[model samples]
Target: MGSPDPNGRQLDGLGGGISSLSKICVVGPPTRPGVDVEFTFVQVGVKNSDIDYSGNCGNLSSAVGPFAVDSGIFRPLKDSGDVSVRIFNTNTGKVIESTFPVCDGEAVAQGDFAIDGVAGTASKVKLDFMNPGGSKTGGMLPTGNVVDCMDGIRATCVDVGNPSVFVSAEELGIDGTILPDETQNMPRLLERLESIRQKATMMMGMADSPEEVPASIPKICFVSQRNSHMLLSGERLEADSVDVVVRAISVGQPHKALPITTSLSLAVAAKIPGSIVHQHARSGVENKEELVIGHPSGKLVVGAKLDDNGEVERATVYRTARRLMDGIAYWK
Candidate 1:
């Protein structure tokens, strides 16, 4: 059991500097079939480091459904069925309804599925983007402009959940397979990327620079195509090599796992006619249900419905999250 603060931030093991561990709760409507499911996020102090609630964890989002089902907060209606959960993130006031397959009247937790940043295999949980482009900025393109030239780089800025500026990795004199440590360790490179992020942030109308109050929006990513196996956890992932690869950063750090919404944005950008991801998308009707992206960790599969007229109906993917513990966490 742990103690949570007024805002749900946890406080435990505060003897040394450590990143805050998060505790989330998935609350489903007690008696309604299609009601909203509230997701409560808590930032637990890592015993020493700063407590952070500045971002929501999509990986934790994976655990919400299972937690709801396991806790009986949301009763299972069938042996194997689809359960939709409308997530109310207390931190951002954003709503995300993620659905997944259930087994034996319970949320499935075992399957032949694996994600880049996560450790082992688990059941496949899919997320559907209803609007596909309106999660963050309330519009497809946050700046209302498709292309924005900043710091001598041409980029496409869009907001699906977190705002991101998409550009090519080749322009930055690197392959798309750069490791997280290597990239983050390079102060000059990081500064340059941060410069782009600041400019893109301003372009997205979020903030002028890093000096200002950091907005929980607008991530910046560089993209390129990869022909080689993606390196993850010291292993290579075997998949179709696409021409467009994306490297995105959140809060000045390479996300261990790509945000679910950002991954959705990648799927849509891959389908659009003029974006950088156009070449990686399926060209014909023969195979149209899958979109796999090569990230620094590995490739992520995204499913979507698209039209020739450039309209994307929905984008989906499978992921896993688990409730590590529950109780209360004190912030202050």
Candidate 2:
């Protein structure tokens, strides 16, 4: 990136000035048993030339299966219908099963499905994060508590698809529904979120000191009960349509849209009895079900499967992907 803007504007490179867009994925023939493709996810810095591989991008992970089939790393399971591709994400050491529609022995790429953040419609790819608990750290609840207080902050340190520190935006003197500029431009507010995130990583044993903690993994989210929210783009979110409001900090700024991997953690956190997400999330969430997440971009629905003990069995979400300019571009 070589660009330095607190707003995450990567003027010097290919980054889209956001965390969701500054990414790279390398897929190859699987080396493990029962896996079709193996991948390592790279998160390029939006403001600098640094890259971190400590986590996975759920949005980009959706494209791995189609990439494998199109690249000849895998083949269609049948002549038609749906083909499921097993992926091993090296970053998290977790296996994800991606099911894509098949047509004439090739992965389908066109359909009527659409998602927030990205424009246009494409073929629906169902990504099921198999046993998605504890992508980093160790157990699902790394701190061994659904809710814990640290530095006078009430937060939940859970590890589902990724490790994240979930805190109440109200505790931080905000409602958790503001837009990127409104919150990202405030140094004090951004500091508070980063401080909580560093503390969370330390508390979860992912890092010994705050300085050692990276900004990508162990993501941070400021949440509040559903309310009227005005986006930075001048859009309004009524109360009834959304169960909760979320303002997630990605890399260093407010995420234009919530990260797909973070949504897995959020779904599991919402299912927990006392996590911050559960406190504000709507009730009647059954095991192996879906949780609708409200973010700055729009609403995203995620699937969660919990055991009888309420442990995260799996987390799933639907996404769309297309191969744009597949040929490589040389960079100096």
Candidate 3:
């Protein structure tokens, strides 16, 4: 193993190939009945020295509940139940609570549930997005419009749990579900999406320019008719294709599994009037509380409760989070 970088170059011994690895942690108390969130994302990649705390990791977000429960950030319940962690994200000034399944008075990790990009099955991790929209730009539609055309792609830019730019699969010459190899083969298509994302970020007011931006939040996704099984990195999701095409971007690439927050954003965008997502979504009434979003891995069920004024009252979903390991990561 390499020695830890004196200038904070290496992060926990993992090669910081991507620009998203620079970070430090200091957990503290929440103003409410949960673990308070206080963490910062630093610049790892020399190319882009900007850290964005506006968005939480949909992947790493799963581990927050377990981290809190086991670390005594919160007292574990006496029975298998929910443990909530109030995330005080530095980037967006937002507090999000991620809930997980606790079994035997300990956080649960074993189950038949599976998420793409991860091997094997684990317990379900659920995240309750408290006012998920506008985590970053202060509005669900950052552009002040539900839908817009960027780089020749019509998209619905909504900030739910995370900022997302939603488009249809057909625009990208896809049916919404393509094999990983097939997608990898289309480097040109991927490159085009990058351009779209860069512009969308500016429209969302996340960056002044795309020159040195790190492709993180305000992810780009495509939607299409749900497939009975969508093959991702060679894995198959056994759910039928939903009405609209759904694809989401994460960390500058197509997320192996759809982001939970982005899923919420998609659900919200699909509801708003004049939004492109609303025009092509599968059979469901507008502002429906429960909407199942079909992803490349499996179908993620999202519930959106709307207020009488037609604004989203609250959006909820079921997910399982487990701690993989807790040890000092050595870097050089």
Candidate 4:
């Protein structure tokens, strides 16, 4: 994943030179009952050409319905209006229920809902992930603790949507508003954050060694008090509009936009007592279903239905989906 071009470009590969652009979602017919389809998401490294399937992606998952309808890879469903694609993520072994708007048994691509980072708007996809806790290590709080101190850095190791190590930005001398390029320019900080992630990975029982842990299993992020921040595109955000400003590191860089899975994990962690993300969470989260998480690019609202015992029964979020193309590319 290291060999970028002279201008730090993924010029030699199909990758778009960013962490979010190098992903492959392969859909297959369902092998399990009560499921509409099976999807295996692959993260292709920009320069190394390596693939990691340790977790699922919410962005690519949005396109599954349209892909299934156009390719006829789903099934013989005899329904209309809204169709549910019960996706079994092979990497995390979890079920993602994606409901998309369809017209005449085909996915409709016209809608008014819009998501930041994407150029245009399209039909909205409602994704509800069931039993999302402990996506990797089989427990919500992997260390059985909320906050842990490691190498002078405090972090919360949780695995709701994915195994993530959440650290307060103040602890790392950061404000959680910097963009991805700053992360790529600083090696020592990334190393430290990764060290925390690897330690949490082992504590969560996802790996015996941090160095041996898979590239994409346990993600990392820095949290700070909600503040008026600026996005990479030079758009300014108001502090009152978000609950918390988060800088999530994905594939060793700051995410241009928030990962929906991370938002779900943060929402779940916010409900729990004494987690890092919970410390600065917005008020009224106990009574509210959705939470607004401020990211570097923008903000995303995530909702988690909690049972009486505070367990996340199901998590829901809205995302816009669009088809880039509808053909196969021949590879040599």
Best by TM-score: 2
State every prediction's TM-score relative to the real structure.
0.77, 0.94, 0.80, 0.93
RMSD, every candidate, angstroms:
5.1, 2.0, 4.3, 2.2
Enumerate clash totals for all models, in the order shown: 18, 0, 27, 0
TM-score of 2: 0.94
Whole-model Cα lDDT of every candidate shown, in order = 0.61, 0.83, 0.65, 0.80
lDDT tens string, model 4, 1-332? 33343444666555677768878898988899988888899887765656888888888888876788767887437545778888888888889898887777778789888887777778889999898987877888888888888778888887777788889888898757888888778899999988888887887888887667877767798988778878877999888998877888888777888777888888888887778888877766656778888886687889998788666788998887766676655444
Q: What is the full ranking by lDDT, best candidate first?
A: 2, 4, 3, 1
Winner on lDDT between 1 and 3 is 3
lDDT for 249 (candidate 2): 89
Error of 1 at 323 (Å): 3.5
In model 4, state the lDDT of residue 206.
80
Best by lDDT: 2
lDDT by residue for model 2 over 1-332, one digit each (tens)? 43454566766566677777788898999898989999999988766667788888898899999888877899875868888999999999999999988778777889999886667898999999998888888689999888988779899988887888889988888757778778877899888778888888888989899888976998898889888876554678787887667888888878888888888888888877778988887776534377777888888899888888766777889998766766655465
Task: Show the colliding residue pairs in model 4.
Answer: none
Ranking by TM-score: 2, 4, 3, 1
Prediction 2 global C-alpha lDDT: 0.83
